[model samples]
Target: MPLIRVESLTKIYSSTKEGFAGIREVSFEVNEGEVVGVIGRSGCGKTTLLRCIAGFESSDSGKILLDGKSVSRPGPDRFMIFQGLDQLFPWLSLRGNLIFAMKTVNKDANMKELQRKAEYYLELVGLSEWGDCYPYQLSGGMKQRAFLARALSVNPRLLLLDEPFGSLDALGRKAMQDLLLRLWGKTGTTIILVTHDIDECIRLSDRILVFTKGTLKFNLINPLPRPRMSEDPAYMDFYGKISRILEKDANLKWANAVLR
Candidate 1:
């Protein structure tokens, strides 16, 4: 069975004046340990779809099943890491956040065990030296790295990333992407990443989903090899395909506006 099954899911904003503001009857399945990337223009419902799966939003129709069980509320089983550097608690140290998360998921864990696990994850993200530092003490990239570590410390069955490095610069984003890939090898956690950057999507995803006007228009497998490079023929092929999808949608939107 698939790890996640989103069947004919629909979530429309409450106001009709918004004119198709949310996803409509989207359906897809993500297998265990698979990394699926969601890409689309702004307001294409990529984030909306992710929010529903994370149980942060309720769908108006259809359902989302995790391991065949319907999801209706947020739980440690599904952990989300967002783009904001403020995701960490300002008052808590980096290690404190991870330790707190470990305790939340496994109440039986003692303080000593929590400390050990926290340190391990901090080291995993290369933030071991900054464990005692507060969120404000770290750079944007470092905070994001710490956020990833906190999410992994919980050992969630599904890791939801909503443009997790959107706030970082180009070099920082690339570094985080590499760190994510390295961490993926160690944890083997299933991931659903929503991103607007097509190149980033291709580098991290095994399959990609393209949305347009809140509809899942393209569900494709990435054909590029690992250690992916922009110069590869297959890389260009995959990029062109995704680019065409978005470009066509943009053209149609422009034509519609002209008619209006």
Candidate 2:
């Protein structure tokens, strides 16, 4: 059975005007230990779809079943790491931020166990020494690391990442992508990552779901081998195919913008 399933999922926002819809009939599934990417142009319901799976938004007409159980509210089984580092509490230290989730969910957690889990996750995200540091003292990447550590510390069965690296510059974003890939490999967590970056999607996902005009346009599976290189023949072929699809979807409007 799929780890998570979205069946005929649809969400519509309240509209004063007669003809505005949010998301219509978006559906997909992420199997156990699978990393899936949701790719689309901006305002195409990528983030909205992630929000629905995370239970941040209720669906208008469908069901979200995790391991065959219905999801109605936010739960620890599915954790979301949003696009902003501001999601982490500024006042809490990194360790405190991680421990807070444990304290909330595992009421019987003792100090030693909490510290052990926090340190384990911090080390997992390469932040072992920064546990006592506040969010303000860290750089943008460090703050993102803390956010990642906190999320991993929770040990959620499924992780929802909504453009988590969208704020970083080129190098920083690449590093975070590498880090995310490593974490996914080690933890074997089911993830649905929504990103505007097509290369990132192809590099990290087992499959890619293209969202367009509030619907799932297509699903592409990545059959390339591990440690994929940009120059690899198979990678280039898949990239070119996706580029053509996106280009057609763009209606040839950005003819000047080269996709490479």
Candidate 3:
């Protein structure tokens, strides 16, 4: 069975003269240990979909099922890492942040045990020596690594990422991508990531969900092999295909039929 199922989920921001904006009957499933990437232009409801799954937004219709249970509110089962470096607690150190995250979800967590786990995750993300540094003390990339480490500290069932690499430079973004894959390999955690970068999506996702104007238009499995690069033919082919889907969908005057 799928780890999470979104059934005909819809959330509208407004139906007034300003016009409607939100996901319309979007549905999909993420299997266990799968990394699913959501790619779309701005205002395409990809992030909205993620929020609904995270229970941050209430859907107007349909439902979200996680592990066969309906999700109605935010819980520890799902953890979201945002695009900003603000995710880390400014008042807390790297190890302190991780310990805080653990204590929130696991109230009975032993202090010594939690500290050990926090340091382990810090080392896992290459921040072992930076545990004493504050959020402001770290660079943009380092902050994101801390966010990843904190998220892993809890070992949540599902990881929700909203363009987590958006603030980094190109080189920094690529480095984070490599880090994400390495962490994903070690953790085998289920993840749903939202991003506007096609190359990033292709590099990290097992499957890609293409959204256009609040609608799910294409659900394509990554056809490229591992070690994907810009020069690879298969990678470019998959990228071009998704690009065309977005381009063609834009030219559509109205919603006709959504591609699977």
Candidate 4:
């Protein structure tokens, strides 16, 4: 059975006028240890779909099942790392935030165990010595690293990334991609990343799911070799294909708007 199964998921938002459709008739399954990337233009329901899976937003119809159980609300089983740098608590130091999650997840956890887990995750994210630093004292990339550490510290079964690298510069973004790939390889956590960067998606995911106009347009299985490089011929080809597909979808949207 799939680790995560989303069946005919649909979400609609209330409005004074016509209701806004977030996602309509979307369905997909993510297997254990599989990393799937969702790519699409802005306002194409990619984030909305992720939000539904993460339990931050409810679906009007359909079901989200994790480990054969339905997900009705947010829980630690599925940990989400958002795009915003302010995801970390401004009032607390990195150590405090990490400790809070560890304690919440394992109320019986002693300070020693919590400290060990926090240190391990901080080292994993290359932020070992910054535990005492507050969110306001860190750079954008450092803040993201802290968030990653906090999420992984809980040992979640699934990791949900919502444009987690959107705020990073090119170099920082590349570093983060590499870090995530290594972590995924080590922990074998099922990850579902929602991103607009075709190159990034192609590099990190074993399979790419394209969301167009609130529905899954296509799913591509990338057989490209590992330790992916943007200059590699096969990788470049896959990237170009996805880029074209996205562009085609955008053009169609533009045309429809003109007609309206």
Model number with the top lDDT: 1
- Candidate 2 residue 137 Cα shift, in angstroms, is 0.3
Pull out the clashing pairs in model 1. Answer: none
In terms of TM-score, which candidate is stronger, 1 or 3? 1
Candidates 2 and 4 compared: the better one by lDDT is 4
What TM-scores do the predictions have?
0.95, 0.93, 0.94, 0.93
Instruction: Sort the predicted structures by lDDT, highest score first.
Output: 1, 3, 4, 2
lDDT of 2 at 72: 78
Scored by TM-score, the top model is 1
Indicate whether candidate 3 or candidate 4 has the larger TM-score: 3
Q: Candidate 3 — which residues are off by over 4 angstroms?
A: 16-19, 251-260
Q: TM-score of predicted model 2?
A: 0.93
Q: Clash totals for all models, in order?
A: 0, 0, 0, 0
Q: Predict model 2's lDDT versus the native.
A: 0.86
Candidate 4 lDDT for residue 171: 100
TM-score of 4: 0.93
Instruction: Give the clash total for candidate 3.
Output: 0
